[model samples]
Target: MAALAWLLIPLFAAIGAGLWGSWANRNRKTAGDGIELAGYTRFREAMEKPDAVVEPEPHSGG
Candidate 1:
């Protein structure tokens, strides 16, 4: 019936979404602790560098 067909629309959508998500994430793996620690170390080293000094321009009186 038309009513049954409409009722199954969401069920089919949910099944399709689940299958797609599984396929999409099937090969994904995290870089884990070593990569994360390296990133933090690089960030700390960059922050310890001194900032550049800038000289102000002299004002000209009209």
Candidate 2:
């Protein structure tokens, strides 16, 4: 009947939402932070270097 079909819509939606939530939350472990930390250290070292000297512009006569 039309009422039965309408009732099924939410039931199906709840099942689908539960399955999607489980799939979305299933965790996979990260390999390690060694590589990422090393890269971050290099980035910090590069950023700490002194700024390069800028040459003064020659005076221009008006």
The sequence of per-residue lDDT tens digits that candidate 1 reaches over residues 1-62 is: 99999989999999999999999989868778998899999999889888766888887866
Model-by-model lDDT, in order? 0.91, 0.94
Lowest lDDT 10-residue stretch of candidate 2: 45-54
TM-score of each: 0.42, 0.59
User: What are the RMSD figures for all models against the true structure?
Assistant: 4.8, 3.5
Q: Per-residue lDDT for 21-50 in model 2, tens only? A: 999999978879999999999999989989
RMSD of 1: 4.8
How big is the RMSD of model 2? 3.5
lDDT score, candidate 1, position 33? 91
